[model samples]
Target: MRERDIEIYLRDEVKKIKGRAYKFESPGNAGVPDRLVILPGGRVYFVELKAPGKKSRPLQIAQQKKIASLGCEVLEIDSLQGVDEFIAKVCEGK
Candidate 1:
């Protein structure tokens, strides 16, 4: 499946568990990741979805690390299952 396909899948799945999901779309964000999901309990997660065999761009990697360093959570995942784990931990309001 394509990245968008998987992204939509993840969004819907996460919503079922977390109550809401959002995708970030800036007019000219050249290197930002695909989505930002906000859960019911006021927590946020930055998700970068990629197809199998794909990797994050350098700037995107740097951004993810920067977000993590700020004590926020970011996930770079290739599979929907990995995304599920991320949602459960970061967005599911456990």
Candidate 2:
């Protein structure tokens, strides 16, 4: 599916699990993830959505590393399966 479709599915699934997925944007800091998902019990994560077969750019990878350094998880989702996998991961240990 398309990137937007993946994002929409992800957001909807997050809500079903009683979480919130916000569109994330950093004006000066480029390569930020697309959505910030917040779950119960203080669970938080970042997700970068891309079209199927697409990969993260170098700068996006760099930014992901930076975000990881801050102790936050960053994931890249390129397909519907990826979104399902992410939901499963985040929903674990809840």
Candidate 3:
């Protein structure tokens, strides 16, 4: 599927679970993740959506690494299954 399809699915799924998936943008800080997902119980994740079989660019990887270094989770979702897995993960321990 296309990246936009995956992103739309993700947003819909997250909303079904009472979560918020906001379009993330960092002005002058290029290559940040595409979405900021916030779930119940204070769970937050930075998500990068891509087309199937696609990979993040080097700058995106660097930005993700930087986000991770600050003790936040960064998820790269390139397929429908990846979005499912992410939703399951967010629902865990609830």
TM-score of each: 0.80, 0.95, 0.97
lDDT of 3 by residue, 3-34 (tens): 99999999999999999999999999999999
Evaluated at residue 89, the lDDT of candidate 1 is: 67
Model 3 bad stretches (over 4 Å): none
lDDT of 1 by residue, 1-94 (tens): 6787779888888778745667776575556667887776677778889996689999889878877898877877788777767766664345
* TM-score winner: 3
> Top lDDT: which candidate number?
3
Error of 2 at 65 (Å): 0.3
List model 2 lDDT by residue over 1-94, tens digit each: 6899989999999999999999999999999999999999999999999999999999999999999999999999898888888888877877
Q: Over all chains combined, what TM-score does candidate 2 have?
A: 0.95
User: Any idea how many clashes model 3 has?
Assistant: 0
In Å, residue 52's CA in model 2 sits off its true spot by 0.9
Ranking by TM-score: 3, 2, 1
